[model samples]
Target: MDWDKLRIFHAVADAGSLTHAGDTLHLSQSAVSRQIRALEESLNTTLFHRHARGLILTEQGELLFDATSAMSRRLDTAEARIRDSEEEVFGELRVTTTTGFGSLWLAPRLPALYKKYPDLKIDLMLEERVLDLPMREADVAIRMKEPSQADLIRRKLMSVHMRLYATPGYIAENGMPESLEQLSQHRLICQNVQATQVSAGAELVRELLTYDVRSTLTVNNYFGVLQATRSGLGIGVLPDYVVEDFPDIQRVLPEVESKEVPVFLAYPEELRQSRRISAFRDFVTEEIIAHRKKMRQESESGA
Candidate 1:
């Protein structure tokens, strides 16, 4: 099998048009067609179906395309690893995490990371859906639960709990709940039980709903709940980590909280030696350590 011909076939399959693939490869349409023909002959299979509009992949073509796509992603990972400079953490680091944690915690601390590594390029992908790390869908991930993917080097970051919070102004006007039974008197703000979230949070919301709450405000994400709570809307179910950054948000019925949700940071084992990964891992570990220390100091002083 000729490497060049396979490359051309991959391009043609990707573009679905011989002319478009030729343009991308900077080759003439006839030359591109010749290579595709050669590849098809070598494989002894009809790779595509010719149509008036564009090329559609045959079953064999789909299999080949899948293989080529994996190759492309592997090449990209290799390129990134090769580009990582020794003794310098400069290059793109694609980090994925839930929107709530990314926006609330990690994003706020990224300035520190940028200051230390000025040339570092960070592509933060925030969504609830877990990306495939081994497939190179993302470079690293910070997730609410431990990642069960094989070949991943994972580190437990910290644990978070869903707790009730309310702005001081709201508490001042509505008073505070002395116990879980008293929560029925005030409106509840939380993530909808049906939305995708940590199981503990949804369980907590389900348990809270049983209190016969008078009013309810349900948002899909914690950010929306936090915003509503900050606006004096109602008592919100939020993670305890927010307390450090939002001192004005007072804990309500501190005893009423969800089970602990463990947070983990994971990356492919292949990236273990990459300087960028080491830098990011160290930075996040240092930040979590500092956060724990500060929270302890505040607690001691308050005690």
Candidate 2:
């Protein structure tokens, strides 16, 4: 089959109109229609049925569409790899990371990275949603939780030790919770990732003390919860590394400590050999390791 014809067919099927497909592909309307006709002839089956509303895919077209979609993605991945290898480290690197880490840590360090590799373009997407690496959704991912996907390469960046933190005003007004029993009297803020039965941080807090987890204000993002806590909203649990520099926030109860959450840097196994990925992975790993001592020192000082 002609790849160009198939590409046109895919565009037409997606747009549901020859004119729209032509505009998208920068081809004339007549050219698009001719390619579709050729594709149908080669396939020996009708692909689309036209109506006043739009073109509807026939049963044969739907089958072919699924296969072609996968093929197009694979081809795109191959092309990206080839282009990355051929050129200098000058292409775009798409990365997805959690909002808290991206905002607090990664965003600040990107300028230095850009300075080091002036030719490289970085697209940093701050989202909680896990992107699919195999589908080429993102070139790299930095997440708080470990990924279980077998096809990708996963590297543990660091373990984030969480501690209970509250603003000075909150502690002064509510008084510091000296022990587990006293913790129940203060308001607690929760950070929830999904609709899971229990959050790891919350579970750890519960396991450590007899505090009332029942009375809590839950937020979706970690940075929001941390900010809320910093503003004297309530006591919140956050990664030690994130709040280390905030002078207003103080660790409330040293007796109650949450378990450390592992952070992972993930990428497709095939892209491991690529210089861009390797360079990024190594830079991030070194940066995190360098900050490990500072993170520990902050936790200790706060305690």
Q: Report the lDDT tens digits of candidate 1 across residue range 1-303.
A: 787888898999999999999999999999999998888898999999999999999999999999989988998987876665666788799999998999988999999999999999999999999999999999999999999999999999999999999998999999999988888999999999999999999999999999999999998888888999999999999998999998989889978889999999999999999888999999999999999999889889988
TM-score between model 2 and native: 0.64
Off by over 4 Å in 2: 1-88, 192-199, 205-210, 213-215, 297-303
lDDT of 2 by residue, 200-254 (tens): 6767655544555446767776678788898887888776776545767877776
- Top lDDT prediction, candidate number: 1
Off by over 4 Å in 1: 1-84
Candidate lDDT (C-alpha), each = 0.93, 0.80
Residue 277's lDDT within candidate 1 is 92
